[model samples]
Target: MSDDRRTTVPVWTLATADVKAPGLPAGESMTGERLAELRGVLAVMADEPIVTLEAHPLPDRIDRGRGIPLDAASPLAQHLSQFITQSARTSLTAARATASGECLYRMVVPAKVAAQLGQGTVRSMVSKAGAGGVLSPLVGPSGKIAAHASYVPVGRAAAVGTVGGAGATAGAAAAGGTALTVAAPLVLMAVAVGVSAYADQQRRQAIEHITELLEQLQEDKLDDERSALNGCRAAIDKATAILLDQGRLGVSLGLDSAVHTIDTALSKVEIRLGRWRSALDGIPEDAAVELATLTKAFPGIDDQGGAFRVHLELAALAVALKRRVVVLQAVEHAQSDPGNPFENFTRQLKRDQQWLDELELGVAAVLVRLSAVKLARPSGLRPVFTPSEVDRLMNAAHRIHQLGVGVTVDGRPTDVAIEIARDKDGSVTVFPALPA
Candidate 1:
């Protein structure tokens, strides 16, 4: 360990009482907390913040110290002795305040756990720990380094006290503003700007790709007279793919990992769509049979009545799908335009992406329900969907409308709760349950 090599990070004190424990391995009362605290002390030695450490308790291992007895007769005395030995070992490596007004300390532990403690406290830890290139992994007691903890502190946090004399404050201030101190901040700022610009360019490229795909979807869907279903399906599939790709990009950009909700919804929609299409394939023949029975039971009602009912059900389903895809398309150009490249990061990108995801999920769910419909001719030759289904679709549409096509919320969108209501024309309306 060297004075100059130690990483500069925040420091905190820990009480021996706080370090006591029912240790990690179910019965190990000393090692679990003891190990973590030891790591924390090591981090402090590296001039990094000593906040807390996450304990990785090895399982099915002896909880007691090595070569220790398990006799219940003197268990307490044995445990106390072990604890004292551990404390002494820790103190040997802890930061020292010398008479010359200097602080010096060093310790070592498993590199993986050490890295976790170092994250955010010091940037160097994140890179070094994550890279695992400069240091070797420490093996614990589990016979392959998994159960044992071993580390050798290779860095020390050392600082000399400022001299106390007349005009000390002025001298210290002048010394603090050395070329290194002034140049370091400027260098860091420049690097930050460069990274921000690079991120902005990547974001712009991805968004541009999304917009191009949306445009293609729109152009394809223009001819809705005959190929509405095919066009809508094609568009929806493209949008889903775009979202999934963006999710991967987001993870690469450090927005989040594999647990993105948007990506999950897209996958679910694709699977459910296959099932929905299967359901839809049987609807026409089923509707014809149901209509024939209705005509037989009611002689006055002609086959035209059944035909109209089937047509309405199919139209409703098709329209719902189209709207869902279109809503996704609309968001493409609707989000907030990118701001200064040097200022914006993935946070803004994530927000815009999440808004689209929520809309996609809601609309996709509506399509799922519509696809599940049996579509048999209604008794009165009316649209087969219940009032609730109609209302649900309408509400889904409303949510999409509120979110819009933009990255920013343009319309002071209300987060309203709605109830099913019938209009004068007997059509369903999603009336707001909460008063204005």
Candidate 2:
């Protein structure tokens, strides 16, 4: 019966169905989408509003030799439909979980409410609660589940009416009197009941199909998010180890007051650099800029002369450096090309990881100073922490480093590192060779 007929599926944004079929008016077929969407209208008319949902193959529209349309519906759809009865609306469990770590409140009170709920419905109840952000912005790098499950509400109805008609005009019958009229009405009633039951089943099945679709979209979005999170954590780990090896964090945070104290010292250095620039401006030189750099990038750096390019190379090594620190080291390229030596193709993404080790200590120090995550330094402050005190400071570093030996510093692996001796006074030295 659906042969050569175009099947139209409406989109979500539209409240009214606009399905256009030629035999009917432009909006006439819309009734099929929502004769108050057929589900609602039927519920209202029938004393019992039973609906059964089932998943079945879509009727394929086969092409004849001519137009895209005008072909028979797919035989598969018809076959599947014939097999299914009113078994589509079976209930599923209410409990659900979202893998994405997205929260439950967001769904309970969705971020955006659509037109299906009228303006009055908003005023009716939900409007009293104010809106809020979906995900907690404070959620750290750790993974946690944050979603809640939900279910759909539905109504049920009863199946009534005789298998066939009971009454008929007996006087107008054939030679057998009541027989001819009696049989005709009975057949009509049989057809009506069967058609009614089938239509009800179809409506229920369609709703269930929609629900499954919504769940799938949510799962796919979660998968993409989880993958991105793993990438970030990997990047952090790689960069942090490189910085730790170069001692950037140590140089940066080795002196408690010294680290925070650098800001005022840095400002003074900048002022002196300006004075030197003015003095050099009048003198002509082959490389005034390089000469000037030698005089004043900063007192810690400039007066202690070194190359900027060298700084860049050291920066690469101190990948675990949570902040900038001065150091010198040689870099060997595994595969050398004409490309920049400071940048390795494999290690580009992990650059910022070095910064965490540096700032974390600084932050902890400030917090202990200001009372934050945790930190402890000597009450007695001088030029810097005494050497003995600094050695004891390593205790604050993870009791067990996350690197755990599989990590490398300058191609030296540390899957297993042993402590040869400890200066019982207060120092621990680990000698990790190429670990097996």
Candidate 3:
């Protein structure tokens, strides 16, 4: 798909039990059908690993108020037990659940991976994972799926297990064989650990990708600005060439000030571009947290990655303004005695003036947007452009404004006005105005 047309997918956190409940509930059992469905989902998501977290009830504690603990030696119970460390099991259980009664499983999917899967598929996966099952009807038909702008992992695990092996172990555990009970937890742990590692790798890759995108955007913007500056220089040269060609007539009109103002503005823009490049170079490599901040702050970063294209446009308008002033001067110099002296030149001057007015407004709007741009910084968010850079841009805009004001038909003949007429054929004609 084209970059502009691509869909955005958010990082999602999925839960197999009621996420809003006061205490974690003993999650629904992963039946054969559910297991098969989940494996299918995982198979589709093989490109990206999903992190899983299991919170199970304590073996020793049983609270009737919350729910009953599962049989300690049950396959599910044994799988939960593996997560409990000898040193912190009690504290972890007490903090995570009520009376240590229920088990809760959570899976976190990164944005890239989630992009490949549909919401219906996710709902089905969650449902099969045991949300809204017979044992937990209150949880609702669909699993809890929370979207995040950033990836957040539950915890890290160590070990790796194949997809086929993990499924087989889960199936074996569900079938209730004593021999398989001992092996199930080990296989599940390996799968959990492998997924955690995979998720970590994905996170690192995401951070790198975001960093590269940001840097490339800055580079592209700078290149465009440089091109715009070159365009301005070319427009200024054209205007200068016109004045030189007009010889004494141009000199008499006193248009040197307008040219100088535009030249100064071009210089300021050039300096700002240099500073912008340096600032972009100074930016450090992004960490995961900073990447999250940038992603949230600049969700449409790609869309914003280009020159404003206003500088060159304004420069063109300035050139047109100078041209109009020269034409007015030439008409006066000729001392023409036409019925409607210099009518076409006056009409063209009006059009150029209107264009200049519109371009000035555009520059003002660009300044407003530039003032609002903020980038991620170590000390917190800061304006992307430095105060000096912004001032330079403003100065350039002011010069463009001044060029419009400086070049004008201050001494043009009053009778140089034009008249417009429209025919039935829908064509319009311009002619020198008759008296009154």
Candidate 4:
């Protein structure tokens, strides 16, 4: 609102008509990238370089008026609006943040600055080595902030402007930089020496701790999860055994009892695992990070091992259950449909039910893991995941692969093109969005 009243101090919009941003969110319409493109176009048309606001006190929220895209709407429209509004509010807060004593500040300069710099129309703000701050750009009557202006903290205005003037060229920079290069190697050498001295000591301590934990897991609590996992495997074995056994109804009843017994054991394991869910959350970020290198590589995805582990266990159970369906279908298909056809049909019905149950459980597990991955983790910490986490995901991925499901979308633009749904025939339908 304060920005609205300043007729002489108007902020520029991105000012591009055909801004091409596929795969970018609508809320990012006035983002710095788009703004830069705007400045380039404006400069080409106006026959002069655009200007940036060098003399910024703080930008209270820049109130770019809002309107929806001409072609589309999405389920996240409300959320997108909320985020854009929040960004405006946040920018405003950042603009005036110094007054509030907020220590951290970020300033996104207007796009015009880039256009000027790209075209060599203006010189950049220079900084003297060891200077405390930077200089602000000068404002001109042309309604542009300054030709070669830059964003600097309100505190750094003096140091940056005076640091290196027109006389300081790349040649001068070379003459002044030997100390920094030498200093960096020396610092690195010292760090290496320190790490070498401490590396063995840390290793010994960790080895001792891990040894103790292994002993405990093997003895005291004995992680019934080991048993649970075994039980799940045993259940699959029993289910497969009975279905494959060349036994009549009377003979198979004993095998069916074994299946029920295995199921009970697996259920106990599931309940036991539920108690350990919180411990997964307690896994140190450092530890989870170490483990993530083994799972997958993606960006901005959170350390999901905590939730993903549970999903893995459930997925394993579902997979084990699903394997029984394959055996059932094989056995039922082996039987002739004409002779005792009703009995054969009943077997098929039972197999279908088992398949559906497994499919539902598996899908739910995958979705849960997907949700976990969606949570906030330290961004770009490392691309590699830890071996254990990777092993877990690989196992889950293997099950999903066996199921052979994938994301799909269909529909006209006038109808819902992207929707998430599950079909009874054991496939997931995902209607993903595409740029218009």
* Maximum-TM-score candidate: 4
Q: How accurate is candidate 3 locally (lDDT)?
A: 0.30
List where candidate 4 sits over 4 angstroms from the true fold: 1-245, 249-254, 265-311, 325-436
Q: lDDT of all predictions, in order shown?
A: 0.27, 0.22, 0.30, 0.28
Identify the superior model by lDDT, candidate 1 or candidate 3: 3
lDDT score, candidate 1, position 427: 23
List the lowest-lDDT window of 10 residues for candidate 2. 11-20
| Candidate 2 structure quality by residue, lDDT tens digits, 322-420 | 122111111112013213222231132123223323332332232222111122344444768778666544432222122122211122111111111
Ranking by lDDT: 3, 4, 1, 2
Candidate number with the higher TM-score (2 or 3) = 3
Better of 1 and 3 by TM-score: 3
Q: Tell me the TM-score of each prediction against the true structure.
A: 0.18, 0.14, 0.19, 0.24
Error of 3 at 184 (Å): 98
Ranking by TM-score: 4, 3, 1, 2
**Per-residue lDDT over 106-177 for candidate 4, one digit per residue giving the tens place of the 0 to 100 score:** 112223322211111111222233243222211222323222222221110111111111111111101221
Clashes by residue pair, model 3: 26-102, 26-103
- Candidate 3's displacement at residue 400, Å, is 22
- Model 1, which residues run further than 4 Å from truth? 1-180, 184-191, 194-216, 220-398, 401-436
Q: Kindly indicate the candidate among 2 and 3 with the higher lDDT.
A: 3
Model 1, range 1-436, lDDT digits (tens) per residue? 2222222211112111112211122112333345456544434443222222111122233222211111222222222122222333333322221111111111122233222211111111111334433111122232342233332221111211121211111011122111000111111111222222222222233334334433434433222322433333443434433432221122233222212322443444445445444544545542433333433432212322232222222332333343333223322322222111111222232343344334444444434433333323335646577987566445434432332222221212211111121112222211111110
Q: Candidate 3's residue-wise lDDT over 1-436, tens digit each? A: 1122211111111221111211111222343244334434543443223223323221222222222122344332343343332212323322343223333233233332222211111111122355433212213223221111111212111222221221212111112211111122222222222222222222233334333444545555444433433343334334333422222333443345545554454455445345443433344434212223332332322132223233333333333333334333433332232222223223333443444334434434433333333332334356475887556445444432333332222212111111122222222221211111
